[model samples]
Target chain A: MWDGILTGLTTAVMPFNLLMVVVGCFAGTFIGMLPGLGPISAVALMIPITYGLDPASGIILMAGVYYGAVFGGSTSSILINAPGCASTVVTAFDGYPMAQQNKAGKALALAAYSSFTGGTIGAIILLFAAPALASVSLSFQSGDYFALMLLGLTAVAAFSGKGQVIKALLMTVFGLMIATVGTDITSGTTRFTFGSVDLIDGVSFLLLAMATFALTEVVMTVMRGQHNEQEPEMDMAALGSMKLSREEVKEVAPTIGRSSVFGFIVGVLPGAGATIASFLAYGLERNLASAKEKLKFGKGALRGLAAPESANNAASTGSFVPLLTLGIPGSGTTAIMLGALIAYGIQPGPRLFMDNPDVFWSVIISMYIGNLVLLILNLPLIPYISRLLAIPRPILIPLILFFSITGVYLVSFNTFDIQMMVLITVIAIFLKLLEFPMAPMLLGFILGGIMEKNLGRALTMTDGSFSFLWDRPLTLTITLIAVFVLLFPLLSAMIGKARTRGAEVAVNEGEG
Target chain B: MSITKDHIGGLVFLCLSVAYGYYAGQIPLLPGDEYEPFNAQSLPSALAIIGGVLSIALLVTADRSVEGRLKLAGYDFWLVAKLLLLVSLFAMALPWMGFTLSTILFLVGGYWLLGVRSIKTLLVASVPFAVVLWFLLSQLLDIYLAPGRFFTLMLGV
Candidate 1:
């Protein structure tokens, strides 16, 4: 283990590798600052570039981008009301208020430190834990894979909520169906290609993700227009000099430690990404803080501001564990990374770590470097980024649209992809109008293909017995866990609603 | 706004999935002696069945639910339609107009639709960004770009 750590550290110290980390962090920061363009998009745009590099170098660069983007997102959320993406929404609860209260620099500094701390700790845990988990997974058969996919799917309920649970389930099933389009791996049958030569290979999830998440986002931005109002320039000089007093640090220390653990566990679960983790952490923090302290949550309470920022950064690192060791991508960005690995002729599975330890460990080590880079950059750059709000909404929308369109087209140079983008964007708009969660849609798209492949393999191996799913203890346990997760929201909602029956109904009717 | 539209979309997707399952049935499978008996068509067909069942379920529930009856407002439809039109246009023009020109036009149209009325703000904000992207995507990264005929002809490289 020490040798592996030393190997990882040594690999990351190479001049070229260090340069890639710097570049990745710089690009990640810019991409995260832009609304609707998350770490996923940044990674997607960079995937093609990585095609030419060594596998270890490519993976490290992408990891840098992922960690760097989370750092960048916190700055925008703190300096302005804009969150850049869902993960930072909790940050905005206190971050924007900090800006308003004239402590933008201090808030930014604290956010940088907390994020660095959370992220580094998360990376260390991932480095130590992933290998042990991967070794256990080496014994996994088709049954285990099938059960794991089921576990991933059941996370929809835990993540999406009761009102939209059914829709999220159906959407996931639809994604699985869509995954069947193209030549089958075992049978070599042409499935849903629809006679289009382009689709014989199947719809690229990268293309689909870009269309669904990025392009659709552009359309929404256009519809919503710019909502941010320019504020007085945050005094850049005073920000750097401001320091966290010992008492103030004492108050937030517990919050940070609790949120870090919370975020790490949340990230361990499939489909539960940084956004949900951060939101859950903030909610927990709110419940724990004193009433006198609680009132300060939205008004720039240091703990409130720090909790989500730390949790989300930790969550981002945590999300990578399953993707690297299990070959199961927990989020859209990791899905794209998996695609990148596949394109390089590397299968991301339990064997991947044993087969290519340098690639796996180097990427892990690079994350440590990425977090440090983000901390250094964000601390001094908050005021510079805050000034960007002065750019009118009218002008910013067009530039955003341009990037969205150009980025997608450049991916495959396919015109048909653009048409698909339009179709998906339309569906996204309707989904948003109804307040449906987009994360589930993303999770569905990412996991859809893998679930189908494993399920197919499992059924074939079992010779038609549905009992195979129940035969294994580990598999059965996972399925039971999934069942419990699916039913959790319904059970909680019913009990909560029952208690407030009369008053809740009155309020509901009044709102309607 | 019509519950009918949602139901119709579901129905259409279901039928299409069934057709896809039939197509998957025709794809060649690996020889039975090598591994498992079930081949390519089985998984897809299973998914199709699940999709079909859920779609029907959604249609039925939507038919009964009053909330599904709400129609999209006029402005919503217009916004969606315009977005579709612009995306299709950008996709088609990309190979011909090049990334920069197509990006500029799309941005202008998008900003206008989104309520950015100032021409000056649009140009000033969009141009520099487009040039920077061109440099990053095309030059620094060495990504193969589909240059416009005009640019290619003018450069004569």
Candidate 2:
């Protein structure tokens, strides 16, 4: 493991590789400043560009985007008073008030430091955890794999959004259906191509990815109208010194440490990305705060800024655990990367550790470098980002369109794909209007092929006996977990209602 | 309370599931194969069943709302429609008119449609972008972008 770490650190410092990391972080932060666009969209949209580079360089770029967007999201939350993404929503809770009070520099500095700590800690946990987890997963067979993939899809669906289970599931199944197009390898027959010559190859992953993210985003932007909601006026003069006082650093240090562990744990869970991690960390901190600190939390408490800023960065690193060790992407942003890996022909599973350790380790090491680059960018460059927020809608929207169309064209050079993308974009916009969670759909599509393959293999081994899902202990354990996860929300709701009823009854009896 | 878009969406999906299931059932099996009931058709057919049931549940249990229709007007509907139509048109025309010419036409029309009134900005942004994209992707990356009849005839290739 130490040797692996050393190799990764060495690979990450190469000039070209290092350059890609810096560029990705800068671009991620810049794009994350856009109001409606977030890290997932940033990664998905940039994938075509990455296709032109080597896998390690491409991953280094995406990692930079992931962390950059997280940090940049806070920048938007602090400067403009509008949270750019869900992960940074909590940063705005205290971050905005500080900006209003002219303590913007202090808040930004705290957030940056917390982010660095959280990111470093999370990477450490992943460094130790991933190899161990990968070693364990090396024993996973077809059945175990299928069950894990099943759990991954179900957990993502459940966690995607509340009360939208039906919609998310529908989109998920729809995604799988879309994957059913073109050839079914075992049968040597086409399944759902509808007889078009272009359809023979099924749909390209690039085409669907561009449609769901890039095109849909554009269409939604247009539908959102030219009248974007006005952001709070930002004052350049109010950005105080970009230095953290010794006391301020001392106060947030414990909070950062606590949230780093908390956030990394949440992040390691399938489907719980940085947003959930940050929220969990913040909530835990707030719950434990004394009367003095509690009062100051939403009013610009140092710990308030530290908790989420650190945790989100930590969780961002945590999210990589499943993607590298198990080939299952727990969230939409990671799913985009799974597609990138497949495009490069590097199968991302336990075998990848042994087969492609260099690719995995280099990406891991580049993230540490990316965070350092971000911290440097955060301090001096942060105050100036408010100027970027003033960019006009007309100019920015057209540029987004240019990237979407051209990116799609550059991939396959087929006009049919471009046309198909437009049609899918229309559907995507329709789904967005309906408030269907697109992440589950994306996850489902990525996993659909693999799930089918594993299912076929597992069933073949068992001679089509479904009960063999319980034959192996590992597979059975995974199956149980999947079932438990599906039922958890329902069971929790029932228990909560029951507790409320019991409390009311006890109160009535006492009054009588 | 009354029917919302969920009900409409659910019904749309239900219909699709039924049609997909029907089509999946039509997939012929291999001759003389002694395999279990599960085959190429099995999983898809099962998914179709699951989808159909879920769609029905969505329709039956859809939250109550006054039946509402999606309505768009003025700069809202037509501009979006035109932009959608414009992209579709450009996509279709790209093969015939070529990447360079088609992009120029599309951007000019697209910017105009999106209400970018500055012709100078449109020309500056679209022309330079199209040329550079063509050069970088085609020449540098060794990617093949089809040159349409217009370009071929004009260049006398």
Q: Per-candidate DockQ versus the true complex?
A: 0.44, 0.50
lDDT of 1: 0.73
Q: Rate the local accuracy (lDDT) of all candidates.
A: 0.73, 0.82
Q: What TM-score against the true fold does each predicted structure earn?
A: 0.85, 0.95
Expressed as tens digits, the lDDT of each residue in A392-493 for candidate 1 is 655654555555555556667888877776777777677665545565555565566666667767776677677667899988887888888878876887
In candidate 2, what are the lDDT values of residues A173-270, reduced to their tens digit? Answer: 88888877788767767788777888878788878887888677766767778434444556766788768878877888899999999998888888
Q: Residue A366's C-alpha lDDT in candidate 2?
A: 84
Q: Which clashing pairs does model 1 show?
A: A187-B28, A187-B29, A189-B27, B1-B70, B1-B71, B1-B72
True contacts kept of each: 0.64, 0.41
**After TM-score superposition, what is the CA distance of residue A120 in candidate 2 from its true location, in Å?**
0.7
Considering only chain B, report the TM-score of each candidate against the true chain B. Answer: 0.72, 0.84
Indicate the TM-score of model 2: 0.95
